[model samples]
Target: GGPRPLPGQEVSVKVLGALEDGGLGERDPRLIFVPGHGDVVQALELGVPTMQPGEVSFFLAAFPYAYGRPGREPDVPPEAPLLFEVTLLEVRDGPDPQSLPPAVRLRLGSQRRERGNFHFARGDFAAALRSYRLSLRALDGPATAPPGPEEEEELREQRVKCLNNCAAAELKLGRAEEALAACEAALRISPDNGRALLRRGQLLAEQGRDAEAALVLRRALELDPASKVIHTELSRLAKRQSPPS
Candidate 1:
């Protein structure tokens, strides 16, 4: 009850109320933990720094600080205000990825990769690239001997996937050279990776290196013969190379 919780500190609290439906009828006893750096809903974020442990208070958050224009449907209405009856329970230092256990770090890396894929599916290539880079960063650690065989293999596979994803995102962003570099990195990890080979081939074709693209595409086809997209690209390249008819 002395030093107030800071912005970059993790805090646990009990929140009693909903932003919509006027508010909860019962005091919600369930505890909620806010992460460091306040990467949370704006209401809790703005209110947390003002709380002292064990102190209970109610705060009304305006729509701008709550759900905004497009609110969370079926719960919070558009431009709805939020009322929170909060009781701060505990405070602690937030997570530091470098200080986490290896298993946790690996999971975080995988989570980042999944987030990248989500962004990529939404056609947000810049966000996808950021997430892919973060995934690799999560896997980065002190340079040392290889890990145990199981973890080593897992890491190798994860890095290869991350690099391949980065290549795809870069290609979408029209960064052919960067895409090629990422594909090269992925291929270094798994030379026969069909996706990486396909990406590299596409980048080569885009750069007008038709011969190199054909060679790479052939290798990719050897790995993934059923890929119609790759087959289409090969046909396009062939037509481009054919003499005037």
Candidate 2:
């Protein structure tokens, strides 16, 4: 270990066993990469700091350092004491999350948005909403300096899209109030956003506010005249408002 592994570095290691009496049983060594600051088993975190590369050490870790109560189940039992024979392989630097370049951050946000779209297509609205929120967080840059006009506009557009997606997910979950807020936030960014307007109108109609829905839907149609979905919604609202002969 030329230099001890520092926080935020990536460490490669081999774990020999777990718990007293080698609870993991006799088996080939297991290799894993642990990001120094990443989520990891507590025992490894405690043990790695003291060991140098190519040094093998045995340590007994109590439940707190192991899986603790309500353990991983079918793997580690509740309140199990763990034993580890560890070998540190190598340490490498990890990227500073805050210092990522703007372009890289935007690309990451796009990836998250794509994941959200995949979840949405699969009808997993909850996961889709989480991914959309994560995308927004990724687009939200560090506060050292404000993004320039072009970058600001790009971020704004991404935020609006994520907000619109969030609204769609919320609507599918029967969370009309949350959906309304998301769509409203998106419209504030892009006032003529037809999708946001359409979602807002749909939510209002679902809540039995047909008149308000009709007004919003009309505005949406103005923004997107070719939207057959908006046209159909308007027709349905009109028919409901019409008195039967």
Best lDDT among the predictions, by candidate number:
1
Model 1 lDDT per residue over 1-245, tens place: 76788655778878765655765522546555444322234567778778888998887877766555665566667777878888888888766666666676678789878867866765668868988887787676643344576876787889899998998899899888998999999998899998899889988998999999999999999888999989988999999999998
- The residue ranges of model 2 lying beyond 4 angstroms of the native Cα positions read 1-101
TM of each candidate vs. truth: 0.66, 0.59
Instruction: Report the Cα lDDT for candidate 2.
Output: 0.76
Please give the CA lDDT of all the candidate structures.
0.77, 0.76
Can you write out model 2's per-residue Cα lDDT over 42-154, one digit (the tens) per residue?
Answer: 67877787677777788787876665565555777777787777888877785543466666667767777886776676566886887788777778747344567887788
Measured on C-alpha atoms, candidate 1 has an lDDT of 0.77
